[model samples]
Target: MGRIKKKGEAGNAKNFITRTKAVKKLQISLPDFRKLCIWKGIFPREPRSRKRVSKSATSSTTFYYTKDIQYLLHEPLLRKFREQKVLEKKISRALGRGDVTDASRLERNAAQPEKTGKPRYTLDHVIRERYPTFVDALRDLDDCLSMLFLFANLPSTTTVPAKMIARCERLCFEFQHYIIVSRSLRKSFLSIKGIYYQANIQGEDVLWLVPYKFNQRVVGDIDFRIMGTFVEFYMTLLGFVNFRLYSSVGLRYPPKFDKAKDDEAAELGAFKLEGNNALAASSQAPAQVTGGADAETGPDPQTQAQVNKLIRQMREADVEGDEAEVEAGEEETAVDAIDKFEPVAPGGDVLPQPSYSGEETESLFANFTFYLSRETPRQPLEFILRAFGCKRIGWDAVLGGGAYTTDERDPSITHQIVDRPVIQAASQKEDGGDEGETSQQLASNQRMPGRIYVQPQWIWDSINDGELKRPDLYAPGAQLPPHLSPFVQNTQGAYDPTMPLEQQQPEGEGLEDSDEELGEGEEADDSLAVKRIEGAAEGMDLARSDDEEGGDGDNGSFGGFSDDDNAAGEDDADESEDEALAAELQYQRELEAELTGKPVKRDTASPQSKAKVEARKRLAKQAKEEAEELERAKGMLSKKKRKLFEQMQYSNNKKSAEDQKLRAKRRKLEKQKTRAKA
Candidate 1:
């Protein structure tokens, strides 16, 4: 047969109309036109120019596919909209007759139809229409995936319903499961807005975001309807992509979700294959019954046997390593190399191995369980982590309480995870035995989990620490996923095991010189107390005082530390200034009370007292001069400083003049002393 022309290639020259002209032909608003096109899988045509459609010899307009427009006229939504418009006119006519009930009834009937359209919108159709093939869809998945995943984590409202959110969540989770099972997860990051994850699916790298756990607020400012429309399109796109992914790995599409395991918060759980032993037993048998059986029986038997053989081979191909079990009879294969398969051409076509070795699986995971306190919130990090095989996880009540399978103290836990301000659990006496507690308590508790905690960095740390040394349990070969956090510094910094410092530039590195150039900043900051003990004690005391005072009396001895702590060590020197001001204020008030001859109030001071004494002396001597002009004082030695103040004032008149004056005075005093010493 002759080669068939591509779908739109052989169409007549006048078959298509400009998108603009199509909107005019529909006699509808542009937005409505666009919506119809999108709903009908119509795309903006490559503009062939204004001359393409000319009503007048000199005028032209853009065009769209005439066939696409004709197809759109039959859309059920269009008919609904038109029906609604007609009813709206009827309602207006009834209202004009002063028949309110009739108008209202008509309005209600017009708004909804007895039966809605079919759910013909499938992801495969959308993919075929837009991308033509699976790889093409995968290549353009970045933005669509990222946006959909973001919306999936957002709180559902009227515009973005719980149902749509749930659908997006499930689709995203299914995709993540594919990554986990296939060991395709790559890098992940904990960003301010959300956790960013990248996975390599059949050589195509897909990156997406999962928002910080429970940080989503359904704000009124955001137009959820618009976002929901986008979400609707994405949900369908992801569904097809997931189907393709699962089929590629020989797994069933729409992997069986354990509804019992899926919690109210929608945390994903392990999904087991269907049918079990009975199906397996039947799958292995041949179809031939006996010689008396029909001729069809023999081929059936042969097909069954062949299928069983193929199934076994496929299972073998998917297996990675035997790291979890070892025996004297078995040889040690480098677990890391298990996933790396030699390139092979099967049936005249080349495809990467369906899965990697056991070591690769372990390395791909090598993750730890994060235990949050009652104070924290579980972020939407599970998807990103699981996508990369950061399995075997658990967390405290802080993040999606009760979502984890077990508490952090479970013996199976290889690494214990905690974030900043970790509330160390008081050592509990083991009533039974001392088993996995040591490893869980020490190392993992030190690192701070950023406000948005992503588990990928934890996975990377676990692998690097040789926590993944047990190949069967953790690190596995070429499939080992990398740390995803951009915040994770890879520098071989100075090693200080005792200190919980971040990865930094190594000693004798150029960073030291750059820091030295910052001068005395290198001198250890003495403003803060040497240890956290001082602040912890203060906090405890404050909490106790608040309790004792019964929330009424001022607990002067241990006021709430929140105000001071919020300022941190930055307010150290300012504390002295605060005290001095308090004393001056007390003196001034006392003086006012004394002058009025009212029984000297507790808060007042006399003019002769400490408050006004200094002020009076300073003013008497400087009365002739304006309080040292701010710019003049700051200038000290350089006219440039004065000019800077003048120029800044010109640009920004709202800046505080009093602040400028204070800063200038301080600068002048420093210069005067330096000049005297010289």
Candidate 2:
């Protein structure tokens, strides 16, 4: 048998250290320890058995790996924290002794490390340690972008300083500038909670959300201090990312920012990109040739002589023999191949690839210009359209700046995305009298010629389908189809809107099986036939009464029992009386059939039964005429009235859709309950 193990000396006990013990080993306060742990990506650990890690009986012990705690001891920042602790003690002692000036001097010296010749603390090394490669940084960019964007839109409070907010906003703007120049922005969506943006950066897709302007409500439950810490880390990360991106494009990192322009809301325009000197020179060479300035600088005499000699050699070789010509041809082909594979730029450095090549693809809106209305979300629409290769995207002036063309009435604008209901201004009279009032009166239904107007959903649908859908389906007043989630995958036998739910369900699993069980032990067909016979007898009595009132003797009269006799069953009737009664019923039936120009036999295939088909045709025709008249009446309404009518229709349709969603949710919950019960 092995020797008995001591307390806290077996299994994970030796591998883990408690938080309090780690903090003591680092000689730092708990808060400082936590900060170090967060920055270094160290998290608390839970041993398989708490008793093994902690000698105490308490179950709520937080543990960290012994190796991780040992690693923290080597962190340079730990030395700074010790020095801070020492300074704090000195300051407190000096104040206790009433030497205020000494305490002040001590605090001031500690704060200014540069004056004291001590190194200033920075997180640059920590950033490198956390993210070893660029792809690692990108993988973590989603959370970083979300935190920064949220802080940028937040209002400053005592806990959240204004300076931090400004820094976040500046970093976010710089990142946006990179996106604009790179054209890596892919898609965006306007949700009730916030706006979502997805971008493809270096082949990695990153998605983040941004709250609408002035929409964030700061609640007390959230800890701003922790968020501020995260923001600080992300700010440094993004700055480095922006630097790398700008450098890749041959543009100087941290592009010159115009403070005055930024203050005036010149978002992307405020950055002035300066190309690298080498790139600038290379780009200028082509400009010089295109500008015809190279003509003034004639070729050197030696270069011209060399070119002439090369041509003469080539001609002489061609005339000499097939051997010389073959040699020259081989050399020429080799040179051409080398040139074809050579890098386009000097020093074998290739130009950065553009995020979008709009010219090469078959763009859906290649020939159209779009104008977004003020109420619609512009950023997302602009980004998606441009991604699919739409060049000119404009928005109403009310939507602010940064548009290709803000003028809504521009002749070149071929499409407009509007979300609000149409309102036609009253037409103006030739005379000036009461022109305002007349113009206020809505005009008749009309539309602008040569231009198409659609809702904002058209853009999303077109992009998802990879083709342009018919505009009429998404027109302002048109009944739109349900907007299904593009992320949801369709499976066989799944519920579909076009097919009834019952039809999609398997026969063995349907409610019909349960109904059949409940209907067992009953003659369903015979009961149904008896009910139909009773209803037909009542119809015959009504027909007889009508015929009697008309005094038509040609029509047969039924010799059935009176109401009193019918109520009482004829139990005492003799055989002769029953036969006589049955014969009288038969005679009445024949006479009635003869009067109506039909045989006594009930043959539905006879010519007289065709009247039922003619009656159905007449009813269908009347309904068609009524529907046509209603449509014509709608067309006659004024524009304002029509718009109001359309708004009502839209609201009703939206409400119905919401109701359907709620019902579906309830049904899902009910199914879950049933499954649980089973």
Candidate 3:
């Protein structure tokens, strides 16, 4: 109406482009376009007005930002994709003509991209473009590590190639080695889906999951191609992260790996670290590892010395400059400036300081040499132990090599992790007639003297708690404490297994808080009834005397007051007085139990118990009143809001009820234990 409106002139029609048009513009296959979009951090987007965006828009059609598609037009990877497509065509044409040699030659050129006219392409530029800084990349590493680790654990299939799985595993192992060397591991928790490991790298907390080593079933329901694409991207990202991590610690990237040992299942052991300054300065390496793999011991000692000298020179220059300043302005130099820290937001945390001392925290298992029993999961336990500064790790002989000692009876081993239930002493049978099977069983089951034998959970718990728990509690056959998830933080009013029930429990909701009060509340009501009877008789006499006084005063003043009305009022007052007197007598009995210590009352119930009962009654009444009030308020609310509030109430009530049951269970256990002690 304003003017003959032009088609696709402005708005979403100009901004959005459908997937088909974008693919056509890119001059690549649909799958290739998708891969490029994924690599280049572009995705199919929705236009505000699909009809206006494109006249042919349908429910099946997907849309993308016109700008994102235009940006991808300049991607260098497009050239490689097109070249590969052309190479595939040449191979297919040669094969169609029955020219096997020509097809094979084309494949060779494809393998060796450098031999071709075009340049080789890599995802490095894309990675850098997506994550501008190292910290940004590290922030995104959670998903990368998770995907890679998942693929590493999965079985190889047609869709999931063996080579890809191997690459994922190697990258994971390299990352673990870096963690061990850097001592950056902070916490680990055993979860149902997998084991979660968290590390602090350059002030960023990176957490990743590793699934349990169970036989993973590759069901057809899963689209392995899509997952494999993600795996491909993650593998490259993790490789880069590992390289940076290795070089950061002054160690060589792609540390010399022994494929033979890897085939033998020596995962972390197969790699030999080549270039750390300390390793070069000290020629001592781990025992007997020299013959296993060929790797540089470390960088040249002279180079390290020169670097150290340069750092020292720079520090000296800074010191000399400070000294000159002090001499020039001696008056102000006497006083050094102190920096003040302020919260960025009002009432927020002030100057958040890093509380952890890395060296001290990492040395949890450094002094202890541990041996893992065959039944325990040696792989995860070993990795965790080594990561937290346990260098001298050993396990069963069946578990692949690189252990300091495979012998269970090795005297150097201080801790033995066992998961198997305690087998009754086979040494008894050995002493008798059975020596063959019994001796073998005895050898396997016998505890080494002075060595702490604990369940596998002990290691995880100790690492999470940052202190060694009492080993005796986790001894074989002992009821180990519940392994709570370290990731699940304890919130207010939630049940915490580590804390005593009385501490986290709501006020007066605690169990066995007043042992004497519990006894008092259970008193014989017959004695209380007799006291009430006596108090009622006394109250009746007092009530009558007061009534006579009131009646005489009223008759003198009014001179014609009716006796029936006076009698009715007097009778009602006497009944209320009797009830009050009975309650007072009960209170006195309880108070007597507290002070004079009446054996019957003390054994039965006490003043505190009576008060607790009253408190509970008051709390119940208050809760009921609040609930009624809430119902009234709900009637005023709209249907949707009322329904949401009801759901919230249901959930809160469910949680509170569960907490009550736990507290009650603990209380019952405490009572049973007390009775047993008695």
Candidate 4:
């Protein structure tokens, strides 16, 4: 009997809405609806069947979730869009008569509060609701951090406002300051997707991506209004996160930034944490305790008297002018000690001496400067370097607006960052005069067809040299910054078991259908049958037939063919035995063959001896299989056993029929191809 239907089983399937229906339900143009959905992060759903909901289902065509449509009606953005359209109409009408002031007045009036109106909704609640706790916010930080960093490095366009870019830059700087002071950075890698950085926070490994210096595109589909709303929310969230991070490390949040040093770094395209003004690093000297706090302190009388004697001797020696010599020798000795062994505790864990450090900054930053585009910001890049704990950064004045030291001869200056290839070419130009002609020539040289090239090799070199300090400098983990990974597909977005050969043979295209069908049949069988056997037997028959046609006596006889058949059967059995061995053994053998390493060998024997050996092997294999089948039968439920048995029989019959049909098809196709060629 058919099973009884459960409650809600038939009618409880999930109902989804189509794009057309959704657009109609919202009473907006399809394009506008699509825009709303994308901005809101709403995703489309797949229907179980076209009969239930599809474009053909109705005259207007398409279906939608009645509930989802009802929820969308409450969207404030949609209402705002509608209101803006009305305001735009009024403004346009006023402007049509050349009433510019009147149009402005009308626009202002429309923006003001009415007597009775709906309260404006902001993204404040969405931010809090999405990220309830600090850690929850941290988890979402990958997306937040990447987006912000990308925007910070982007050029100001109509789609992306300069103000928004500046805000993003400031927030990024604030976040970086927290990273620098806390020194929570662990590791970073340069990736094509972006620079990836990982840090440990509260025993959790937090990874984030940071984009390259400047490589963001303001695409049309991305709704800046929704993004701006999110940015506002994240700005507040990051403010709190930064505060918490600083306070935890016993450092003041928003520590006094030295405007002079900031200006200097900005000029030089580097920011150094001020060591004297505000909360200076020097102020954090280790505490020294005097003798009387814990117990009654008394100096040993003999020791004190001996110290006084040494002091008096030293005073007399100083009178002799030997103190200066002693001081110089001590300084040398201290320098030697520093050279011999200097230990550091990175992240509060004992580590060997750093491979890169401040002492190497001169060499590190030597010729170290970036030439920014006319559109690139000098402050943001400088701030970024400082945030990553690099106090010595330099950029070309073409970018820093002559606010920086442009002296290439300056020994202290290290790294140089440049975006324009023309800057590099012009600076390296042989002739200094005819600047206009030189620039035009350089501009022409810079143009490359079919590519908007941003050289990341400079970033990579700096990162590898350990000059770029941001934890996420090298795009690592999920924190890969934007455009860090290059555009390339490692694999075609499809599955093919036989595809691995494409790598081996570059000239090879796709496998033919006949070959694929054969492969599929073989793989489906899940048996250790040798494909070479059929071909080998045919070859043996042809050899014998040729010998017979030549009238070769014993060699042409069918008697020896009996032994050949037996030998081939024995080899097939041995191959089947190898197939059932451990998968690792098979893999290792293949690997060894590829490497031209030593291959494992089996003792060779005559076909009759091999047959005897394989016969025993087959018996053992059958015994193991029978025992496993018995165990499985005992454990399985009766209903499951019946179902499994039926499934096996159905599969076997289906496979037999498919094999026959495939053979027929293969013959027909071969015949057709031959005819076409003829």
- The candidate that achieves the highest TM-score relative to the unseen native structure: 3
Candidate 4: 10-residue stretch with minimal lDDT? 285-294
TM-score of candidate 4 to 2 decimals: 0.41
lDDT of each: 0.52, 0.66, 0.76, 0.51
TM per model?
A: 0.46, 0.58, 0.69, 0.41
TM-score of model 2 vs. true structure: 0.58
Q: Write the per-residue lDDT of candidate 3 for residues 207-295, one digit (tens) a residue.
A: 99999999999899998777777777787788788888776766667888998888778888999877655543343323212322234
Per-residue alpha-carbon lDDT of candidate 2 for residues 319-356, written as tens digits (9 for 90 to 100):
87887767799788776652234466664544434433
lDDT (10s digit) by residue, model 1, range 1-678: 999765444444466676666777676667667656664567755544433333332334445668788877765566555665678789999999999999988866653311332342333444466777788878878877887778777776656666667777778777766665566766655567766666677788777766665667666787665565566677777788887766555555666666655654445553433222223234211121111223224457888999999999888865743444545224445544445455465433333465444455434544454443333334444544454455555664334423454454455544433334434654554556565632233333333333223233444444334243333233111222333354344322223232322232222222212212221321222112111223333344422333433534232123556535634532453344345544554575579778997754352323223333344333533542333345335657467766787788665533444434444454455556666788
Question: Could you tell me the C-alpha RMSD of candidate 1 in Å?
Answer: 21.2
Looking at model 1, which ten-residue stretch has the lowest summed lDDT? 284-293
Q: Number of clashes in every candidate structure?
A: 31, 1, 4, 37
Number of the top lDDT candidate: 3
Ranking by TM-score: 3, 2, 1, 4
